[model samples]
Target: MITMPSIGDNLARLRRRAGFTQENLAERSTVSVSVIRKLERGDRDSASLPTLRKLATALDVTTVALFHPVPRFAPGNTDDRDDLYVMRRVLQPARALSGGGVVTLADDEDAPSSTDVWQSVREINGMFRDSDYAAGVAALPTAITYARAATSAAPEPHQATAWEQLAQTYQTAAMILIQLRKDDLAYYALGLAIDAAHQAGSDMLVASAVCSENWLLTRQARFNEAERAALATAEAIEPSLTRSPQSDIATWGWLNLGAAAAATRNNRMDVAMDSLRRARAAAHVAVGYRSPHVTHWTTFSPAVVAMREVELAMVTGDAGRALKAARSVPSSARPAITYQRFRLDVAAAHIERRHHDEALDVLLQLRATAAGWLRYQRYAHTLTSRLLRSRARAIPLELRDLADFLDVSD
Candidate 1:
């Protein structure tokens, strides 16, 4: 079967094969230097199609070539999805696995409702929310089994909640594995989430599944594809999905768009700006009292908004604006995973401004935080090493240590 490397892998490969560093690619492709940094790091998901075309043209390749599948574990081939996904999860030091025992989901072919199957799933989510990575990872197999079984079972209208629950479980598993640097496994699980959502025939379920998949697509840097998926999901569900407090389907769609826009290339600033405006409008519409889920998404404080703005500013080469936005991100509000990502963006912005000291400071923090998670992410280490070596400045000592640990050198 033909497969595509996630956007990050494809861009990195094309850039190197064309004998271009991130800086070189940034200069040629009209994509911001920070975007090049994130794309190569595998932390970003989307890029503007126009920018992609530029990069493709520069490499003397078609746009489709950017989506070419990366072979699994070929010698000198460091694009393995699994390693990358694992590294993403553990990159934050304070998020070490803590509690929650493994709970298995048994498949009963005769069962009519998926509710029983979802009990284990809820437990897993709780464990994850509590930062219990070990617990979440251990329970993943059971959740997958139950979800598959639920999908195969006969559907009952009353069992919609069960199916939704199952879909969410699969999504949760995907999220965990992605953070763990297991992208292939995460993709497989996300596929299951999509299947469960489809089978459930619930718009809310579908939206939730798409929300999760959107991030996965972004990591590959497939911005246009990811936005399409989000928009399609929203449009499909809007008419059927109620506008009540129970679920703010519209708001979710807008958030997805905002994120997608932030990932888009520097050349598409207008498109990105439009998407953010819509996102802000959607959030405004969601101000009234609502369900826990709706409130969680809609009322999610300005912190996430600020983060997106920082991303937008970085992509636009507005260092002052990006720094201003970055400063608005609440230190404690972000989880370790997201905080590390924010720092990387800040570092890139500093690099753009030629503030080497600031950039090195951010890089050091990343190194300190990311070292604990190194065992989980070979791909990130490889990319970071390459960036470090290619840059004119001396590599930070901490990152040097991390490179040695991963056995990856630029």
Candidate 2:
């Protein structure tokens, strides 16, 4: 029998899992915050049908779904799976990344070997390294499927490793999806990643997953939540770092926190800079000491530290420092780390120095390198459009080429 207490507990669980506060739900559902609070706390036994409907709508579920454990094989189940599979296929084409391209529903998941799982993880990592965002996004469900199968197939201790790998894989997928403007998918992937990390008892993996979620929150413009998530990740890893001096993982948390702070409009530039300085120092320690785990997963070389510092400098309006740091990163090598976004920064810096020719040169190089469909392409186009919009003098021919690419005429 489903008692009122059981019902209330379920409601509270689902509400929290959906990343909502009582006030947030109340605002969306047109129910008083206190009434919703009372329902969750078992202080209210009954709600009107209309109030329930509002709650269901705000939660993006049917009222019946709210009351019951959703069956994995229900009609809605297949509906969600089909939607997920199609989305996976569309956003993640096979050739977009290095490894196995797509996961057919008919693929045999029951027969994967340990080697197969390891190779797949490597491929996923390569996809991220290559900035194959779409392919990385597509491979998420496949990873989760393999992860679930691995648990049932592997014996006790091995199951833990399987969970950890899946958590990392899902975290990567979540980050890629966030960049692609797929917020709902990003949220779900990160949630799954967090659960798997906890199940595996991997504090490091847990912090990594939290970092990804913090990024998703930042993108959603939820500055407060982003800061909290980043800070929590840093705090989780700080204790471990003290004993082991594992700088790479520790620096990652700090870097993420600094990114969140820098992104907020109200963020103090000095504080952000200080955080970044600490991150850079930690990254140097990680790179120098060469811990095996850090080398395998969290290695931060001098180049990465320099690039991140440059990015922070640009955000903080230190153009000369940004320019010097930008030159420190070889163009061919840095693309994998920063993606095409760096080109826009270089161009912006050039414009700041009244070097439109140099700026146009960087923008043209970007056009040649980045595939036209990527979001960065649109960003470059817009920036170039703005630069060319109002000029005191006649537009240079090189600048005109950029205007043509953006499909905007002066």
Candidate 3:
């Protein structure tokens, strides 16, 4: 018979696999030694989400990985054929670019026109917003080639627009690549994006590129550099505030959001809060108007600022404050991805507070609303496993089915 391991069992196994003694893990995670000992010994039945997050960070693993045996198909597992195939495809253009080869459009009877390229870029941006990664990946290569061609072929007046389109396309590709954990490829794509933005000669576009660079840095765990990049970008564009206050405010607010996120990651709570305050001030000036420029997906509005505030609070280990801020975001103001993140934040806060049922409810809502999106997020698996382990009663059928779908065993 197959045996189901408890969370403690899984934790102990992962700790051993990481070659960390209890004392070492305790020191690294900043959890007390006694708590770590109790957890590994199964004497403690549950842990706060923040504590688990710290331990997972120290272990260089996702929190979900600490809850159960790593799946055969896990992303980093060499044996995962699907992962291997996706990684190969995602890295193809980056590898070619690194080797000093440009990706060319396949020979055809007619090349895509500038209008066609612009329309395609917009469609791909929509696909990204909808979280349709596969579709975006399928469309990207041709779009990239067409956008690059248009940039070179368009009239002087139209050249900047074409370059902006090309930059947006590359930025979209970088976004998808990062989500796939193909950070090297993502970095290459972002560099291309920045170059195109500079060629476009738009301060807004450059600021957008800087914002994306900050995001890449944050994902790579270079939090200090991410903070610096964001702050510099915001400052560089501050002079434009008088000429185009709304556009400048949007860009500035978005950069502050990035700065806040980086600060939060570095455990600089004061810095993070200060950044958020600046973002909030900018948002007030913009008054919820969306910038006409395609800001590389940076939306600056009151709601968006609040969303970042909630996220910062979560990162700072203030679950109550996070939940409170999340609740204040109006539904009309919440974009699809932002709403999804808000729900996840709510669930995370609940988990930290030991409100398992409430946490599960929020997760179930997310699953129902965006099952495909939720499936790929490691935190979803972590939250599900926590719920399963924390409750002594038989698992709810809905929760169990969700866990099974995510391939989370015990």
Candidate 4:
């Protein structure tokens, strides 16, 4: 689904169009001739955003212009591609009614209680956090439908809670779809989530939904948009450290963390680091909160702050720092698929350190523990591919097995 060409492709096309030889471009950008050559020849996965900015400045283009985001999907067979049909039906149903009316298959059925609807929403969240994506996906439509019915049928005071529940369900559905790379459907679900959140008249809820929006944008390589939206939301919801509730601080901190992620990917090192610092400050307050709060069960845990530090360091190709930061996140009791993604950073750090056996060990452990979720992670596949390519001889059976599971091919 990622249509972007390889960065090398974009670079070659742009350089030729601009009538600049590699040497000429290097002279203009102050990048080494060798680095430019390696990049154009596709020998490197990526350059730091600042390096890319220099290249873009010389080419008279935005920094993003140099980025051909790496493709994130494993090869999909026919069955795999259509696996989201049920979700699509729910999210993008071709309803016959366009009258701004509630259309339903069970109009005569009584609306569920606000309590029931909220419970259903919580169950779906629980399922997703447990990595029971099948249960989560199966539960989503029912939860969304019941929530919608409640919004119309519940008492006026209860209707707001219904709307909020609906918003949360929609957002959760979007999160699931995003993991599956059903981005179009995720977008549809997120649009409805935003609407329901706004209708709930809770600015905090809306902010929470926007956190998901920021994540989606970040994944799609829309770094500038993600950064702008997240920073703005964080600013709007900037809680008073002394008086704000723990949830408020967590939400505000989560926004900064989101901003940090976007900024990191865009290669704005200073901006990303600053946002991480702010998020860490908030994490100090949220430490007492044991229950997951806000979007994707995100908390301002020191682990999360450390996770971002590791991510930023990895993106900037600082394996040593990444490995150091990785130590801050405990290896035990890392709950939620969202937080579990940090292990990939750990594996990548091991790779960078040329600890191939250690890297493989980490990946194998991750899959052994979270097999279902690992199948959906394109980064895992990408990392596996790297290890596979780097193996000069004797590809281990486990490595081969992992590659097959990831649908990775030579």
lDDT of each: 0.57, 0.59, 0.71, 0.74
Which tens-of-lDDT digit does each residue in 359-403 have in candidate 2?
Answer: 778777766665433333445666677678646788878778767
Model 3, 1-410: lDDT tens digits are 21122456777788899999988888998877776776767665434334555778898986545444321233323343343233234335454354212332222223436666766677677766776665555446545656766776688878888888888888888887666566777888888888888998878888887887887898788999999989988888874444666767777888998999999999897888888888888877776566454456455678888887777788779999998888778867644676687778788889998998899888888788777567767778888888889879888898898898777878
Using TM-score as the measure, the top candidate is 4
- Model 1, 1-410: lDDT tens per residue? 32324667877887888899888887877667776666667654434334455777777886546545422332234464442333233222134554321221111323534445555565666544544454455334444445445555545654566666667777787776665555676787778777777766765666766776777777677777776777666555553233554246444634555445534662565666666665555544543424433111334334555666776677667888888788867776443454565666777777677776676666556566664343344444544555576567777676676566656666
Candidate achieving the largest lDDT: 4
TM-score of 2: 0.64
Clashes of 3: 0
Ranked candidates, highest lDDT first: 4, 3, 2, 1
The superposed Cα distance between candidate 3 and the true structure at residue 210, in angstroms, equals: 2.1
Ranking by TM-score: 4, 3, 2, 1
Per-candidate total of colliding backbone pairs? 15, 0, 0, 0
Query: Please, what's the RMSD in Å of model 4?
Result: 21.4
Q: Give a tens-digit lDDT track for model 4, residues 255-348.
A: 8988999998998978888899899999888876654422443455777778877877888899999998887777652435655688888899
Off by over 4 Å in 2: 1-110, 137-140, 239-264, 288-297, 332-335, 372-374, 390-410
**Backbone-clash count (model 1):** 15
